[model samples]
Target: MSTARFLQIHTLHTYTAALLNRDDTGLAKRLTYGATSRIRISSQCLKRHWRKAEDPHALSTLAGYVDAYRSRELVTEKVIEPLRGRHPDDVVNALEPEFQKLVYGDKADKGKKSRQTLLLGESELTWLAAEADRLAAEAPDAKAAAKAAAQWVKGKNVSVLAQNTALPAGVTGALFGRMVTSDPGANIEAPVHVAHAFTVHAEEAEGDYFTAVDDLKKDEDDSGADTIQETELTCGLFYGYVVIDLPGLIKNCGGDADLAGRIVHHLLYLIAEVSPGAKRGSTAPYGRADLLLVEAGARQPRSLAGAFRRACRPDVEEALRVLDGHLAHLDATYETGEARRYLSLAQTPLSSPEGSGLERLSLKALAEWAAAQVGTGADA
Candidate 1:
């Protein structure tokens, strides 16, 4: 077993004439660093793309993986809907309010049909459905069923009950985490941490005014285009960062170091290959990482975003050079004993300072090497 506690992955990817992420106003997201605006992509957006990608390396392909759902109607769809025809209508209907009150707050009113969305594991939903069925079968009436459910809510533990059905956390919950405001025991702390990606240089965008012409327009009709619109298109070289807590990942996987290792391997592939974008039909925004760097160490993870505080040139070589200098400075000051591997598409080889311990490797080798660092504990 390796003695590494943290695995950090960093990448530099460039996209052209694409709108990857947008705000409510239909513009590219931006972040101000060093008093200059930089195009940005949120961590949430990046994770969604990676998690939902239908590739060979997807997390859904892992053995013993349970699917997870996020929705405001978890109780309605999973519990109440399944029991509608199987049990008495009144008994099943009574569960909605009780379950809502349990999940939301005691004062959750019926007037608001849409509540805060929640992430629930498939096992947890199955358990809830089974409980509803049992209550419907045993209750003499809806009132008794409601009272019994309230009592169950007051006494029973959700995490314990869900564990019987299947893996309660699911793969996504085990990696990204789940939050239950009313039930603290159901909450899972995310072991994988993601940072928002931003361009290394100042923000650059263009206003694209476009129109679609109707194909069946009559002759001499002199009609205008069928539709007209304008959007913001941006070209940028973005720097992305992700960190995996080895011990926390193993704990989330029920102390299975092998499973944690497999997860890390698959996640590394997704990070390097997945493309996050909006307006896919029009923009066709897709790009692989220009540089992929993986680091393994026992120290707490730190982001290298500060290297771009002064905003490097848009060229990948220039950005990488700036990063190399910053890394040398950090190593000199902290003496962090981290093992590093990287793959670069640049023309020149990466220059690491003496004793920096940075090695060059292919993406496949880098991913495997990082996964091999997963162990049971810090002292493993």
Candidate 2:
């Protein structure tokens, strides 16, 4: 007789649920069954199970079996239970053992059972149906309904990493850049520059770096009959992080693999804009580059805001020049109409003199005029 090998499908489900809720710290304890610890598998492995089991006629693979069990529980509890006056026996049977394993074990064993319980119930299915109905009711047409559903599934996570820094209100629009990567074998669109510029606050340590730059004095030298003057220079270096929603950017770029490359290249440009000492082709002494491109922008913005505040206008302008130069240097770069658009925006005036209500104005008017000129030059 052949021996039957049983892989713990329920245990896998419990672990997956825990992972979704970011409960990795207690995963080992949460997944224990009998005397043996359940083998740890990645969320990627679980995703493979879902893909393989998606076909209706697909054989009873481990993932498919788990998915079927989950679907039936949702239907029974959400659709059948209230109508039939009884809960599904299988739902309780499928969940109770794992509940006991999690709840009855040691202090370490008590993990995210409450979260797992919600997954096992009809709530998700109910919510999905309700959402679909709400969309249908609210949307003007069927196309709008479909669009809403598409956006809901492709929802993004946007974060602003502005910690203890006081940024000019206009900085918000300049910092809004996307990050994305190309799909395998996809042709990359030509890269474009995306500038991220800011100034540092006075209180922060990183802010001190820029203030030192501003305080540099001019040097002068005279020889024979001529006089010469030179301005002192300061090297500004600060640390900061840019938060991005990679998946969202990919969607926004219309799911084009080529466009995704451009988006990612643009993000790299933004990072380089803020970190002058960090170059793409350059290696640091520690074998690590000065700039760190963090995925999901996980680091807290508060931790980085101080460093960002140290970035003065000159530093930002220099960074933008570097970014533009890098894009022009790319051998395979393609013209994606971004450069022309940027140039047009940079040249366009914000408001006319009449709009400013200053036909014959004072020094404040002249100051505003000078500031506008500076702003246009900085953007250029």
Candidate 3:
């Protein structure tokens, strides 16, 4: 068992004129809450940005981390392609269908079409390639090879095979989880619960009209813009919430408490520093959280989104005050005495209720404190 059952994290980040996330029709995403419209960023978008971040705090940079591929072409690209020239064409061709069926079940296409994208770790893919090669070499013809592979699949246990891999679903899958409906055993329950971030107040957005000029055109030429378009841009203070299930995370990392601790540490940085945006070059959307509050406790986690239920002012200090007030209300009603630590960049710090020992620390110290709560001091 871990020291803490859950680590609840709440953050307030402000962005300038940038389209952080967009709808299908190319407009800034919005959600109506408390009977008011607010700019929204999906949890999926946040997870993707954090998973693929290239910064020093990126999960991919962790030691012993394996890459995972989520795609429809996983069998072809990772399993079959590597074995194509190395083995006979007939043998290689025969293994594709059987592997596809093994992975995607009865609905799998014979010509390498998957019912859905499969998320597989590098070790699992490597194992499949080796298994295909062995089955192919033992068979007399393509027909025999296919039969042998299919028979092998029936007799084997995929989940067991997956567990045997050095890293089952890789770092991202371990953190964000993966769903393989074909095989429930392959599904990993996500330990990190991310809420869709929304603006504290009403949406503040505008349509930005832009033109693309043809640099090669001379003054004598058409003297007109090559292309013109409009895009939606919004600026607001977003409230982001995330929950870490310590026991779940530790189990997913194969009982490595130290590794789990490091993961938590790096994840804190990713959440606060990584900015999810649409147009990077044009928007240059990047900002760190102005206020970060972390709570460690053994009880179920709750979000501070109620702080913005009535829509506070755009200022960070106002948001903080509202947040503190809401938290106090929850404490008074439920008496949930969760150990709390916070970091703030605002001129006015968080005002905790008297006798509620809420320690304020810097970002580095905050992350370190979270890692320690998970029972380790190792660098992320």
Q: Please give the clash total of every predicted structure, in order.
A: 0, 5, 0
- Cα lDDT tens digits for candidate 1, 206-225: 99999999898896666788
Each prediction's whole-model lDDT (CA): 0.83, 0.26, 0.84
- True lDDT of residue 355, candidate 2: 18
- Judged by whole-model lDDT over C-alpha atoms, candidate 2 comes out at 0.26
RMSD of 3: 2.8
* lDDT score for residue 26 of model 1: 95
Worst 10 residues of 3 by lDDT: 371-380
The positional error of residue 44 in candidate 1, measured at the CA in angstroms, is: 0.6
The lDDT, on a scale of 0 to 1, for candidate 3 is 0.84
> Which segments of model 2 are wrong by more than 4 Å?
1-227, 269-293, 297-303, 306-380
Worst 10 residues of 2 by lDDT: 6-15
How do the residues 281-310 of candidate 3 rate in per-residue lDDT, one tens digit apiece? 999999999989998877788999988988
Regions of model 3 farther than 4 Å from truth: 1-3, 110-114, 219-221, 353-356, 376-380
In Å, residue 154's CA in model 2 sits off its true spot by 37
Among these predicted structures, which one has the highest lDDT?
A: 3
The 10 consecutive residues of candidate 1 with the worst lDDT sum are 105-114
